[model samples]
Target: MEDHTAGHNKEKRYECDVCGKAWQQPYLLKIHRRVHTGERPYVCSICDKSFMRTQELKKHRRLHSGEKPYGCSTCGKRFARLSGLWVHRPVHSSERPYTCSDCGKGFKLSTDLKVHRRLHTGERPYTCSDCGKGFTRSTSLLEHRHTHTGERPYTCSQCGEGYIRAKSLRAHQRTHTGERPFICAKCGKSYTRSTSLREHQCTHTGECPYTCAQCGKGFTRSTRLLSHQRVHTGDRPVPSTVCGGGLAMASHVLSHQRVHTSGQPYDCPYCGEAFDSSRELRQHRRAHAGEQMLPLQQTFQEHAGAAGAPADTHQRVTL
Candidate 1:
């Protein structure tokens, strides 16, 4: 009987009837059967989180220990789990495997694709308990937590600026380091972030794909058009640049440029001195003395006289 048992010891095979899954080990087969039975024996003492498999519970306990074994080769970022490091691998490769069904937008991971799909469905599950601000993912909520807690763990070594997220800190450090990794293919202009470079590329392409239904005004990006259409409804402030003498748009700057070149064509003929701009002429007509222009250069004289030396001390010393 001992010789027969020793021969048959390695020949054991077990299969689950419910799932029709086969396992070589009886212990593995018993574990597999729990999936069908929905029985979770392993439970976390701290959080009351239950796991059907003991292996999953063992992996989850690493979060409590704060053990991040898997590290990214490109950024040297450590992740709590192997799956997190697996998801982060494409960032270094710049790979977008997941594509959006609604807008055909691509993402590096399926989790990002899931967030993009929420825009089509308008689903924002993660919400702020205090202000009721909704977000698609919990990571956004974690970042938003900094707004309340003021807890910025990530700090830049160069500028000494703190950020809630490591990505934001990395981007901020580029400002001090003068590092622009994302380069434009057409203009050769570089940006610290890829999103900024992508938005800049639209200017070279002349692709104003986002159009307004009311004014028919086109915008290269959705955010730009959203801010622009708000002008009609007075929902937001009129955006302006200081370089254009306080003009709202580039087209407005072009018109202002023509006014400057034409020596203020709509100016008052009473004034003998012609103005370069219409706004300048309008302010001149008001007789309100314009604000004092700030001096561009700081004037400094030689400090040889103040150093207990005469103005002609060099000639006296030579004689």
Candidate 2:
């Protein structure tokens, strides 16, 4: 059995003169004594940054060297420190021990639990030193600092993919793994993450919650509406993907070619007949099943009313 320090050493001993408190370990007491003396012995070679503890200085140096020695054996995800890998491993394992007191949202790490607590408390302590923008956590402030510094140190070895944060890098690595954890309970549509799955679910429900102020068009996902709004604002995309075909939305690239094609690749499972568009295929399936068509003009009018847009503002056909 391991020695029980609390049971054996109950008597007060090794007291700090500054705080009038005792310590279990003399090494811890010695380290605590440095606060009174204002001594930071451990120094970095790259930036000459100093830390009270040697371990803290060692971790700080890894930020400069881009060294992630600790790696997950299962997912091949890497971390600068073992503690970070410890926190990250649970995501792969789907182990959520920590939960929110307010909403009962489960999280793997205690740090995530603390960050989630801010939703209940509304406590923002970490304010940006440069811009005075407030964040609930110190990690958020650190990420916000990257915006000012424009530092994206994390670069992928495979495809030279870059990210501002380590967590984003981890998520980007999943693209190679083909691991889609989030699945739609209703449609069986799979996504790499829960957020994407939620957005995909909205398409089936016909729920376009985000409204564009300029065109008065509503989108199911906020990201979609944000991208659509860019069309008006003259925000051209950086062209991540290349194609010979001229298309607007990346999602419509495969579907839009039906205007010229003789063979319809998309087929109605109910009738086994091919259709030009997926929407047409859906309508065809409904027709075979003896379902009445919702009045297209009336549906467009309802959608326009919901988006706070005039029906004549944009030439939109309801499918």
Identify the leading candidate in terms of TM-score. Answer: 2
**lDDT per residue as tens, model 2, 47-140:** 9889999999989999999999999999898999998888788787677889887767798888889977875687889998876767777876
Clashes of 2: 0
lDDT per residue (tens digit) for residues 195-257 in model 1 = 688778878886667877765655665556655554444331211221112222222322333
Stretches > 4 Å off in candidate 2: 1-12, 24-28, 64-69, 95-104, 120-123, 129-132, 145-198, 201-319
- The local lDDT score (0 to 100) that residue 260 gets in candidate 1 is 33
Best candidate (score: lDDT) = 2
TM-score for each predicted model, relative to the true structure: 0.47, 0.47
After superposition of all CA atoms, the RMSD between model 2 and the true structure is: 12.2
Q: Residue 147 lDDT in model 1?
A: 52
How large an RMSD does model 1 have? 18.0
Estimate every model's Cα lDDT from 0 to 1. 0.61, 0.63
TM-score of 2: 0.47
